[model samples]
Target: MDHTNKLFVIKLTHTLIWMFFVAVIFYVVYSGITGAINTYTWLGIVLVIGEGIVLLLFRMFCPLTVLARKYSDSQKDNFDIFLPNWLAKNNKLIFTTIFLIGLVLVIIRTLF
Candidate 1:
């Protein structure tokens, strides 16, 4: 009900969402590596792309992060989410690379 509670809720939600996407990304990678492409693979791809669009709309920041910013003035990278500072700092770069690799593998498997 207060700002602290609100920020905690936001951070928790953001962390859960991040975990979901991480699972999706790993599923995509697994699908590609195993040549098990299916409807779920496509769904994961679509979800990741949609997430990318959302990030772009927010100028590369998660909407939750933007919202969380209003509640806290911490300069730490992980302030908006329940991630380690280093992980939060490199989250985009790390996950994007993994997603792209999986995408490329998916394309190759699909074409061949």
Candidate 2:
């Protein structure tokens, strides 16, 4: 496929994934707030805020942003870490980082 098609497909995929994520998060937050789930405290509220910020950041500066930059500048790279076909690639690392950071934040919040 041409670069335009590749970018288009990637972007469309990203948009769909992002929409699903937002919907899930909203549903969970709504459930939490409405007592559909177990009781929640201020920590739940803070987690919701964190989720929103992370989602916004992903939407605004996604892996595809690098593709746009490369396309605009006509630059070529050896390979892309976030390429579409690297299934299950680097996922553990990314998730581990997220988990660690979230765990640390929760611990600090609990302590403080």
Candidate 3:
């Protein structure tokens, strides 16, 4: 496969993975809001936090974003994931805030 094909594959894979991640994060947040705290909830929180560490370690960029840099020269935000440019640029902030809020909700639910 050539670079074009490789880039296409990478983009498709990144989109799929990102979509799945968004879905899982949404589910976790919804569960937290609905008083569904359980192993799955904590598992999702742990996974999100773990990935946040990866982003932090990589300078707030997902590992896939770092990998995508090798394939494309475009400086746009969506160069990595299928999200909008702004969202891609601020992905870390948005996701980390969401995850932290969810964690807090879970803790509150547990305490109350």
Candidate 4:
């Protein structure tokens, strides 16, 4: 396949995998907050916090997007992924807010 096609494949894989990750993260948090205190509770918190560290390390841009930029030149908000334009543009904000809320819920449930 050509370079562009290869890049598209990589980006598509990344986007699909990321969607799964988002779902699992949310599930973990929800479970943790709802009294399912188990490994998932800690795992979920650690993973989300780790994501925050990675985001900071990448200067708030997803590392995959930065990598995709090296391969493709499309500037459309969703060019690198299948997300909506607004979502692709402000994913960090949206997910970060959700993550924070989930994290709070986890903490609160763990504490009391």
lDDT of each: 0.97, 0.49, 0.78, 0.77
Ten residues in sequence with the least summed lDDT for candidate 4: 28-37
Judged by lDDT against the true structure, how good is candidate 3? Answer: 0.78
Sorted by lDDT (best first), the order is 1, 3, 4, 2
How many Å off is the CA of 34 in candidate 2? 1.8
The CA lDDT at 76 in model 4 is: 82
lDDT minimum window of 10 residues, candidate 3: 18-27
Candidate 2 lDDT tens digits, 1-103: 7777676666567656545544444544454444454334344445645655764778734465466555445333312223334333443344435444444
Which prediction has more favorable TM-score, 2 or 4? 4
- How badly does each model clash, as a count of residue pairs? 0, 0, 0, 0
> What TM-score against the true fold does each predicted structure earn?
0.98, 0.42, 0.87, 0.85
> What alpha-carbon RMSD in Å does predicted model 4 have with respect to the real structure?
1.7
Stretches of candidate 2 off by over 4 Å are: 38-60, 73-112
Candidate 4, residue 40: lDDT: 70
lDDT (tens digit, per residue) of candidate 1 on 37-112: 9999999999999999999999999999999999999999999999999999999999999999999999999999
Q: What's the CA error at residue 90 for candidate 4, in Å? A: 1.8
- From the highest TM-score down, the ranking of the candidates is 1, 3, 4, 2
The candidate that achieves the highest lDDT relative to the unseen native structure: 1
